[model samples]
Target: MSDTIAFPYPDYLLGEHQFRGDDVRAFFAPGGLFAEGPIPAKEIYDELNASFNGRGGSRIELIREAYDSVTFAAAYGAYISASTKPDDVVILVGHSIGGEKALLASKATLSAEIDLLATIDPVSRITTGFRKPLQDVSVPESVGYFFNRWQQNYPWPVDYGSDGRIAVQDTASTFDDQLKQNDIRNAAGGTKKRGCTAPDYLKGFCKAFSGTTTTTRTDHGKLSHDDWIEQQLRNIIGEKLEARPTIETNYGRSVTEDDAADQVFRWDVRNHVFSWGEQDTPSSVELQVYREGERIPELSGEVSPSGSVDFNQYGLGEYVFSITAHAFNSVTIKQKVIVQDDDSSGPTITLTGPASRRIADSAPLTFRWDATDESSVREVSITATGRHGERLSPGTWASGGAPVSGSFSFDAQPPGNYVLSRSAVDDDRDWDGSGSIDDSSVTSSRSTSFTIYDDDTAKPTIAFFTSDGSPLLDDSHTESHGIANSVSWSVTDDSGIASVDATIYQDDVVIRSVQVGANDRISLDEFGPGDFRVELRAVDADSDGWVGDASERISSVRLTVTNAAPDVFAGGMYLIDEGDLLNLKAVGDDVDPGDADSLRFDWDLGGDGRFDDAQGARPVITWNDLVAHEIDDNGDFVIRVRATDRLGASSTSQATLTVLNSAPALVSIDATPVADENDTVTATGIYEDESPADTHVVTVFWGDGQKSA
Candidate 1:
């Protein structure tokens, strides 16, 4: 007898379907396929169990109905109790849902030695609502040899059968994509419908047909007893399994076999270069140089028996040197390198500004220059001298590299001659073949001279107006009701105005200033509600405002900005009778709290959209007069209130007032006397009302007892 035993478990509901029919006669009958002749799977298990006198030492256990609770629990408990031994092969063969139970069984019996675990198209427990589908469970780690074969060609719509696929994923196991035995090739030769062919009734019943049905009855039920599955079982029993191989990254070595980091540089003052690859290896090495983190390498080359790569002719920056050494396998190593500057010439500085020997005394002295170096310049400085040829106390300075340019300014210089000078210094570094000058620390300077003169120029005259062609009647002050305002101006200067500028002021504080002319206009878009002033300054060739003497003028009008409208809030509605003195309040408030009282309230009693009744600036109003025309069908009317601020800015609010109908009146009431305790007593009354009500309830009470309504 074979030392190993196969504990076969059939899938869910199909276990009996696959094992109990003539279709599987070849699977049990001896000499047909197994050579041992007819023997049921359970018979094999029972014989093995009885050999040990039912003491529970069985070579095989056939677990059927694995999807059923009772059968599965009993089988699982039995498998767990069977103590497993080393060198003993416990082979498990499960199909469909039975496959799920096999995995569960293995997991439950942690100590059981599973030499081989094979599965057919394992499906989930159909009766258990598919809570844990057989397709989702993975093989337990305790199993040694795992084999999974499934189909993937189930017919459309009726995809209940295997599609030639299984969810069991064991990367180290024997996985085969086997062709399902349900094919027409495996079916008995016949003209009648069989195998992949569907019955005429089935074909006609379906709306559309795509060839023969893949789920032929012969295919689904005959899989477990098929010739191919039997051969797999035989193969497992014969111990014909292939070994799985693994790949390695670093050849499983604790230390590298190459020297890379210590090989690359040759630094020099004027020029430098990096070289590597002196040692020879079994295989050629590949070198790549990058600036680190960057995918694209700046330089790349291969290392042969006698090859060295140069790493110069580049800008000054940090770079990464990477070596990919190849031998029986490959390995990577990285190193960092920094390239320093190498230029030795002093940067040249040039100055340019007012070329005239004399400039307006009121105008500022503006000087500009450019500095450059072959490699890099560190700093630049500027100096000045007075008319008497005395050097100025200090100078202006800037710092940067080649191709740098900037400017410096001096407020209106006193009427005198002055000289402005500038110089640039290169970075301190010595270079080979740079004459006697280290170039680093070398400096270069330049200077220019000019004089300031006083001039006489009068302030410019200005005027203001609205974009709508309305002149400020006061000429110096006006008020606006909206944020959008237009201001137009014109200026005149005796010395010929070079340009005109306007400055806006909020009360006494300056807000913004802009250059303005006859063709230009100003919009106070950002100006909130407030009082402001606009001042104009015109500069001529003498640089009046550009210097100390500013020719300026102010608007003749004070602009009172009341752009925000007052928010109106009418009080709650009320129901009142005619001739009643009703008090109502329609309050108004401007954005600026102080302007709240400066609002006029207007009332539209009938909500006719017209404010015919005006209440000056009073927010509270008393209404005693109501005309019949103001009442609608429901005895209701809307009262709208509009509030207009002193600047004419306005907003509106409204409320509805509903009138009530006359109350109901009782005409008379009568009561009937009761003769016995069980006798009924009645109370009745007559009433009238101008309004309509849903229902009327009446109640009668016994003087010494209860009442009903």
Candidate 2:
């Protein structure tokens, strides 16, 4: 607050007044807008003194007062530490060189409380020091940046345009070691990279900043230093703050509680010291109440110290109250609050106690009051004007919750709210029989509402289960082991207990039946078979799916009888001709003389054909066509052996006849007749079999018949 503290951004003011850079404007517009005329921070306001004004802008230094950076830093440190409260935050901003000071004033840049930051383009040099000035490269978490790029071709106003690089932002400067990203390249290349030089690193800052917000806004600026300032403010704050807080920057720079807007409850900021006691005395905290905007009433004990007191009791809009605590300036501390209200305004209508509630006709109801007031003796007499205002019985309102309880009941209709409240009653409610009543509003213990699920109430849910899988088929049998006695039902929307009667039907016969309660239980240790259709009749509420009762279908496992083979035929069979091989030489022709080949008979001859010795006689034999098998040389089928017993009981023992396909033989050779005088000969052979070979036999009768014959 002493000498002429120059701003580092003097050049910004010069450019802003005459020729501003378009890079500064594209931020909102594409060129600079607001006058960046001599943006100094020592005293918080800009002083524009006209210089040599011409088409080519006058050169000036964008500077600030000495110690500005250190002072801003100190102020920020104070604000964040022992001052700010939970659910409260502020955004600090500055343009050009002022922007530099603003950055310096960041306590969060070090302590880590300030959430967001934005700098159009902060000045920097390769040198590393606080005086060299740059964002703290150490902490680059939530910082946002936007470099005012100069338009390569067009200028603003008359010859107005910004294309070439005017200023460079070295975010990697060591001064910003704690608040900005480290630009290692700054150390490596000593200077900016050629083609890629457009403040792009700062562009990343803008992109990161945009993402943190829900709504987005775009702006443009010009070449002049007079670029948009409000847009920058909005970008920095986003939608986080309830209302934007603007710095009072006319001349001298200083923030006070009075500077805070109405939306802000309190504008309290602590220096580097945290948990500092605001006033000399400890904060007054206890059961103390006072009127809005009035001084806090001192508690019987100590009083919590705050700047002011206010509430909406004066009217309704909005009110803000904040306490200036005495924390002894500890780095971290604790605090508490106590509420004491003289809430008294005789039996004022609090609210209707279920004046329009629905109740089931089957259930009874009782009511109570919840109105409050504290002035004279109060009494509330309410009459039961039922759903349609039908006069209800007086005994229904009789009190009985110990001293006073009320009851209302009916048989047919459903439950509903009784119009029980009115502005005026019998007027003489000061005495409850003998004792004077202090309040009039009567509260009720009655039910609020009710609903009918189906016919009159919620139906019971009957669940059918089986040890078998679903899709009951005809062949499927409820296994002797799979039958179950358990069935379940749920009263999905019922006011009463659910009961069930499960009956199982198997083709009209009652296979099993059981009664189940609330949950349900049954055992199927003995049930089985037949087409079962289980019927579950529930007795709780009405059901939608089943017209009569809920149930499921089931079937029993199959019982099949398989024909077992009799001891008749053998396994190894041979094909034979019917007419050629049939009955064995039946004694006296007992067998038929027709069957021979095409028999295909399996003989149990050697019962187990896979043996070397003759098989035991007692065995089964099979025949594809028994009638076609050879009986013997007679072509008959049966082969019987007559046994003459000692007692003369002559019985014929029969053995199964088997046929074998024998390879055919050459039956005979026929020779053709020869002529009597000349030499001529002819010959032929006969063969019959499934497969026969060629015959080779020759005879020649020379026409000299008498000698060669």
Candidate 3:
């Protein structure tokens, strides 16, 4: 184990150094938010430190956190610069956003190499509108190995429908190509409350034991506190183990020791031979054999130069053999061999039922076979290979006697090509004339193959792929309106895709539908003032001729459809006298019958093409403010009103507003007493008026409302 650790932010820093009252209260007071919770950064640092503290290495622990990308890089670089010492084993671990920040810190420290990097759902609340999901956190090329583990929170809703931590791909190098292991599991307390368990065999020099350390809980934050995960990390740093020698046991089944560690190996033969090898095996080695958990050795001795041991003298029971070599340090190769008292020769078996034929997965399949042996058939094994892949029959071994026939019923497999094979073994083997069965003369029959097929169960996937064959994101823009838009779709299935049906919906109502086979483009030309939902449904074409229906699968995308323009009509021409108020109204019509109330009306009083004002359904225009540029013309003002639908579709209508001039009205009057006028005396007066015709008329008015002209 090496000493040195890094974390983001030390809450203890505020309490111990800053002496903040709130921080002290939260750390020491009771009934606070972190009273029993809140595993502070310092605590994590201390816990990791205890694992490698006295192990003898230069100790260094650094912790900090910054939200700004620039500051984050600077802080991370400072930490890496501090760890410039040679032979430094850097173990980086973080939780939540800190996990992502930790990885970023490693990425920023390009010159540093990481021995182990682990993360628990690397996530962060995007404040800068720039973020990488957990899935986007690629393992640094310089990191020796990475372990990414995340437990889905309750409700298990992925962020943006993406659980970035499920698997890491699209990195500088393939995740499979890197020395890393990615594991994701649902937290206990969700649909399936299963606890997290580490693999039995560790990777590199780490040994991860399989055990339960915590009960099922919905708190996703507890993953960082998971004792199992922490213990694995501790083991990786503190309890590193050297690689062990490989051992295998072959008895009709080639079973490797790694595959069946500490498992009982059932042996029915009278003799057993063990072969072993090591990287630097000495000329001679000691082998010890014991019976089930016994310290006293049942047998211990040195074998010849060859590393083979026979156990024909042993009786039926459980036995453990330990082989030790000087090359390995304190690592003993142990094998638990369980010998059963069933030494027999294998019998000959033949399949009598399920002749080569096509069947549906829902249908029941019956397998019949005959087994014959001179001594008596003991067991029969049935196996199968299918189009989906090869599969072993559930409980393939069955008990039977010589010249016996039996049948087993099973559900049909998914659609694919398949081959079924069977073999049998007899109850007795060839005896060595010493009242013992000869292990070298075991009886077994050659396996025979038969063809059987089941209907395809996979449904075709419908993808709205681009020209390069990538799926289209939702609400993608299209320029075609009332014209064909390029729409490409493809359906995939394990079996061949039969037919695909594409449909367009306007506001959930089906508008157009067509059939497209295999890979083909269907033109979508639905035009209206509503949203569009394009759906593609597909079904698999099973060539097995199975009599069962394959359900259709569907994928769809929604988009906004541009609205068309509405038709506007203004009332016919109207004449109004000067100073007389005139009102003009315009009505509009739309192809979308439902958008009548949402239509907007605009009026252009000058008929200059640019709408002056927008109003409700009806817009009123008064001729009082009307100015006639051409008085010699018709004195007609072309008032235009435009109507637009909700989707920006518009139309305009024009009407003439004729203004008529009234008779001249007296604006002013002036009279001069040129001569004294009384009843017929000469009098003169001048009157001013506003009218198209310029003229002067004189009239004299007497007292008492009487006028003379």
Candidate 4:
């Protein structure tokens, strides 16, 4: 049964082909959005073959909406080749939005020499800004906005005092736009009044198996698109007669403006091996591909120290591509088959049941993935400040397995560090990938710590920083502001020391403090604000501790910080004037500019009350009130000279004046009565308000009557 060939575009797509039938092969499928819908066959279940909708807008417009979501399912997976392309094993199952539009139409018509995709739940959903599910803190604010680096720190059941916890808000709900073809028509639950037999079997498999096979997702939880494609095509030819998918995923390493042929994704990995197909017998001791923790760096395959593994690629979202055989020599046989796509409802961990609240800018570390698993995950990582600081991104999700409802998300982290459990593993590496450390289900791989500085940031030296009352200032100014400015900053890190938290942004608003030290000086005077900014946030206090929070660097803050700005600018500005000089500058430059003894001139018109204090520029503008107050006989006047130096560093210098109100006077209009023969008397004008009387630019020397203007 091999006779289809229509593949074109970037060159022979949809699992290309070189058949001979390792176990019945043939690939290619198109028509996910329309091309008539349904040539989407499958030699396997790792169903991936979409072609468009990288996101929603921009990013090349979601890769041109994943290039129209999958250009007829990638022209039926590149003309449905598949007579035998590497043990066949063709996959396409579709769930959430046609399983993420079949690998975005096999990356726009398959050709990377695919093996297994089998997606289930992916969520490139235009951009997944929010499509309903919270009803409370917007469901962890849209699942911590696409899996916030592995649930930040897990342990979230949420209750931060009600109406709280739900960050990641740029805002945008109502199912957030196009959303991967409306979540593959809602993971294929098929409704819209009925008619959705998986979209009429995807329009009868896009007009009777257009090519042969190619699919990104399939179904199970909420899948529809009426699937049965020939007993799932004998389970992709019986797992391609055992197994043998190599590798190739690629995502976070950057998919470039969301290209990779437009993304639909399922591409998660973890062992991904297979056996039979003619030799190399191993029989699946491990081969997972859950996918969804933000899609683990677009996983590829082939790792040593083990058996075989692969992951091709799928970028849009929602995933579950699986094939587990579980331990052979150790005797452990486990088989879990689940392929979905689009809705992207995997990785979740709860426990927010009760705990200190108040989370404004960042906190809600939300949790409760009773077990949510739809697939299309892309990024989740965890913690990992690795090097020796190892924790290698822990947290986790998929617990025991069940719940389901969109990946929720998280944040809080840093505080002291304790968090454990959660679970996602096989993150795929790089930043975290979260794949090992043995999860046996996490009874307590090391959870809950974040007490001190979970992650604020401030350290270079002085892990033992002190500040109970010595920041300086007997009147000297190194550390004196109300007596409670405690600052014991000790942030050690053997493997688990966690925090020292602190922030005193006077007028800024960085406000924080797990312990201000010296018996917690009221938590560092409630995070100070009257001319005191310590911010020595330490971390490594002990949280089963680790902090690859890398973004700002290290678990969170590796800013050994030299915020020590005492090389100069000592702090001194004092002045008070009420009526004498015209524009006596004083608005804002940064700090210094006001000193003389302290300069306090007060002539409240209510004068001399004993409440009158004096500093030093005393009685200096005496030109009879500097020209009787109207001032400026305009010879230019600008006397301003200040300096509080001695370390107080206030500096100002101004000197330029020529006031001669009575020096250039010569009144002689009465001597102009010499109306001799011509009869025309007029000559009286002398001005100097800073020298200005060009009087139409005139020069008249009455000696011979010469006028030039």
Candidate 5:
């Protein structure tokens, strides 16, 4: 007999069934202080029980807390020592705070051994300052295999603070010392622990034993139910169960090697026959076949003891066949037969396309392919990838008719290096002959590379128009100064218009370049009076590196800008006493050379927009000459200046002049001879002021202390 058993069941059933009366005792412990409904620990326990004890023959327990874990582990150990065989498997899994308790239970197993010990994100309240130390947080030597998973950044709720709110603490690293000592070998034959030391807050446990430390990003709360952790547990348990022995039993009797010797069966692949020896002819025989994961009823049935089942109607690929035979002494024998396809030939394809061509001159590029296969063709797909490895949408084609050849075409594409790929599939893997191909069908792919070059040779055309959309001829345009004179233009090209730049030039010298849009006005107010020219250069949006014709790339209009109004600088405010002479000066300049030397100036002293008070660049006048209507209450007069170019274009400016009033002076006093003190005396004084707008009051004094006016 073989020392170890190899069951032909699926992976999920590895540890679920009992073989040779072996027992799998599994213990699970959850975190948190309360045993709530549907906790992670209970869920994990249910799943593991379903996997390990699906036949209701194994022992599994869910411990709610650390105290209960210790009590249950001791009790279960006693039970194991009394009833379990030497080959039974013991598994212990714990999460969060319960992980520490599980380690303590490992040590409490005494003479019993734990086949597998798994801890996920363990936390210690004593090390985190929540309580006093109670037990050793280390892996026991009694553990045959250890798997540890941990995180050091997720927070856990602790006691409430003084503010009446629950506080959280990062206790993920509370068991670092225990983890460092429990490091084991990884799948690569290297140590799970890193060589360098990390800080306490950043330290974590390594998830080794089964493989290298997992790098999956997980938190403390989610580590208990993490998919990686659950898968690791299932894998370790499955491995342990598969390494044990298998004992064949009949109705209440054990089957000896001799009793099962003649029940052996052999599958004949070439003949599609499943036949067994003739030793079990005293009872019944059963046969079943499964394709993919489901059974095929037409291909499975009961047969005679020495009979052979035929599978010639089935198609290619893998199929699982199960056979059972019962002997006259109630000895039952079961076996599995796997039939796989031996055909190796796949679909053949030959793809063809152009090597290189210009997108502008080349017609629609045609792609053709011929596919041939021994089986019916299922589908054919095509894809195109550009220069930057970006995929262009060409759409996929699928057909059930299984065509052997096909052709397609692509319109003119952008200039770039492209790769065209075609793939064909054949329906050769229909294991049950259902006319539908399985995912394991034969597929063949072929790729061909091509390049599309840009060959745009058309230059952009520029057309100038006035504001009213009328065509404006080149060199026949005249624009007035001091007014907004604008022109519009349109640029177009066969490829596309990239940019249209407008530049202004004065006397063959470059001024400034401006941006222009279609039908948008280009203002000429910024240009001074001169022989100016406006040029527009249009560039096509061709992506090729070739520079096409440049002779007709630019269009220009040479026109004469007429006279510009002279700029006037009127002298600033002036202050003079009444009867003092005031001199005023003004300066003028014209941008047009023809009008520069002939610029004229005029002034308006009254500030009424009429420059008739004075003429010439400089004028002089006395303060007293200013009319009363011209000088304001503050004795201020505003003077204006107007500058005119030779073409009669004029601009005006102004300044203020302040005049001070002069005091009246006494000229002469005339008095009649006053012989007596009571007689009336007459006195008069004459005053002359430079300001004619001022009126004066007079007073006279007599010799006897009485005053008369």
Candidate 6:
């Protein structure tokens, strides 16, 4: 047992205990909405203190949620900063919603180096109002290991009444049934209900758990105190303590080496062995090497006393060597070594090409060169200087092997006198032999010159027109009046026309294209009624290497083939008596602004998929006019209306009209003024009916219980 100590604002001290040897610290937090109380946290803290008594000296802190003054995240951060040391073995455990808080705290205090993090039946419902619901929980890189325990069958209740009391019990079926009932209630009242269940937390936990998770059938409220969970915690803590590293102190003399200390070797040297003196013999020796500023151990192992270490595989660089000697006490020695390249011989190159001469601008020119080096040729670079002294880089190429030889070709350079210079470099100056060859005093150079003449630099011009010889403006709209429209274009270039490409696109997608001469015409018969774009590109006969040469041009025009089907806004279920007049208005409009008033409407009151019953925007229909065979089994008739545009594109809408049967009406009944017992009586009834074609029968009843028809 340990004494209870009070902490600052966010951290409330539940209990503290000190073990014997290892420096370890554990942090625990309880679970609840906002984590305002600390009953379960205190229980787990006592168990941990008792379990860690014989293993090592540890400090345990129970962190309570202090959401009043600060958030749970900030409170955990402050507690970590105030209570933890950099070298202590840290363990963190949280239950329920506190598990989420623990994960956040792990990220906040990454420098504390948490060894383990365990969460029990973790839930993240508090932040659901503003943030997205937790889908998966990711383990922070700062934690060495992670453990998660959860229950699946039974979930804790989350929905509360107006008085802030949970509405349902924590049973599996009870919770589910209550949620279903609440959904029905909410649907009837037109309100939304919020709930968090065990499956919600399990789904996220399963996605995040890299290793096997502990799934229990126990309820969420008792999961933290379950026997299996307690045993798992004990086993993990014991293993962590056993694997903890022991503290070591340096108190012996430094080990001395006999090789040239901190020696620098050229890249040409392959092998180097470092040996220690035999006079101060040590029982055992260990070696570790690392690059500067890097903590990764490049090479590490144990060697015999007075033994030599061979570093033949290491490349040219500066490295630190650490050697440890174990005898009466342990001692470590550090030294540095540098490896570099010192070659100074330059490469030799020779250029061969035609002498300075004039050639057509469309002709291609080629130059060849060969370079040789003592060690190895690394790279070759070339540059061209135009007549105006402007420079153009031909890019550098790596040799890939020893001797370098290649050819450079130029295609239709701008009409000018150009000097092409070439350079080559060997691997001599590449210190460390990393292929870092550059232009220096050891680089070889050569040059050649030529002149290009008569280059055309004028783009082509384009113009468009309609079939009527009227200029067709860009981004223009036109109607498809049941006939194809024709468009013409003219293109001219000074160099000469190579080819013209004309393409028609509907809704940004190409529907038709053709290769035509400089002057050509196209028809819009194949295209449908929609917005379209026309693109025309002209290419000149200038043989330049680059695409879209100086004398190439592209033009585009937007064409809207303005004709669309009318949108019909009609369809409903109606009830009416037989022979009753049903007035149905054709409600619709054309999408095209110019075609709205030109729409025509027709009706199909018989449901025969024909629009012959009537014609107009609004039509009065009658049951007697409907075809008897067209009526469905339910005594209902479907009245359809079609709205068509001037171009014949149309849409149809329908409605269901149920014709109900009408009963006969009675006007009055006539009888004798007085009737004697068992005497004959006569009655007459007058009735009116909407269905005048039906025959009627009348029945007369006397008080003596005898009826005649």
Best by TM-score: 5
The 10 consecutive residues of candidate 1 with the worst lDDT sum are 25-34
RMSD versus native structure for model 5:
18.2
How do the predictions measure up, each by TM-score? 0.23, 0.24, 0.33, 0.16, 0.38, 0.29
Best by lDDT: 6
lDDT of 2 by residue, 1-709 (tens): 1111112233333122321121111111010223334443332223212111132332222222243445544554454443433333433333333344445554244443444443433332222111123434222332333222222221111221222222223454311212221121111111112222234333432233323321121111211122223222332333343232222211123223343242322111111111112333432322222223333333122333322222222221122222222121111111111222222233433333223345434333345444333433234444456556575565544322211222333333334444544222222232222123212323322223333122354354444434442332334433322224232333233435345566766566777777756454444434433344556565654333324322222212222111111122222222345223223221211111111111122232233332222222222223322322212221223333332212222223344443444455567777666545555545666755432222333334544674332
Error of 2 at 36 (Å): 16
Candidate 3, residue 242: lDDT: 34
Q: Candidates 2 and 5: which is better by TM-score? A: 5
Q: Model 3, 1-709: lDDT tens per residue?
A: 1211222221221122111111110011111111123345455345444533333333344333444433554576557646554455565565555555556666666566665666654454343211244455556676555666554443222342234442433344423211111222221111213344332112122222355333333233445455445434443443223343333333323333233365555555445666555444444455667655443243566643235666655545576666544221222356667766565445667666555466555455666777777777656655555556656454553323322576655453444566655666555643232233233334454443433444455677766754345566777653324333455776788777777888888778998898877677755443644667778878777644344546568878775545567777877686876555556667777766555667788777655667864455454443334533222223566777778877677887888778676555555554554545453454443443333333455556766698765
Please give, for residues 482-519, the per-residue lDDT of candidate 6 as tens digits: 44566788888777799899988888998888998898
lDDT of 1 by residue, 1-709 (tens): 1211232323222112121112111011011101112234554345334422344322233333323533563466355436445445565565545554555565555566566666554444443313235545556566666665443333321344534343444546533333444332211111123433354245432222367433333333334444345434544444432221111122121222223243333333435444444243535566666643342244675654334445444434465655555432234445556654444356887777766767875555677788877756677766667768765544344233223677766554556678777678876555432334233556777767777766654566566677675665553555554435657766666665667777887766888877767346677647666677766665554453433554444444456665678899876685754333446667778875555867788877766688865464333333323443344223666777888876667899888766555545678887675557667656688975533422445555656698777
Per-candidate clashes, comma-separated: 21, 154, 16, 187, 0, 1
Candidate 5 yields a Cα-based lDDT of 0.55
| lDDT (10s digit) by residue, model 5, range 598-689 | 88888888767777777888888655446533562337777889998866889988888887877877887777855577877565557777
What are the runs in model 6 whose C-alpha is more than 4 Å off?
1-271, 277-283, 290-299, 312-315, 327-329, 344-403, 408-459, 463-490, 500-539, 546-709
Model 1 residue 63 lDDT score: 34
Candidate 6 global CA lDDT score:
0.58
TM-score of 4: 0.16
Clashing pairs in 6: 19-57
> Which ranges of candidate 1 are over 4 A from the true structure?
1-283, 291-299, 341-363, 368-542, 545-709
lDDT score, candidate 6, position 568: 88
How far off is residue 482 in model 4, in Å?
A: 51
Which stretches of candidate 2 lie above 4 Å from their native place?
Answer: 1-561, 569-709
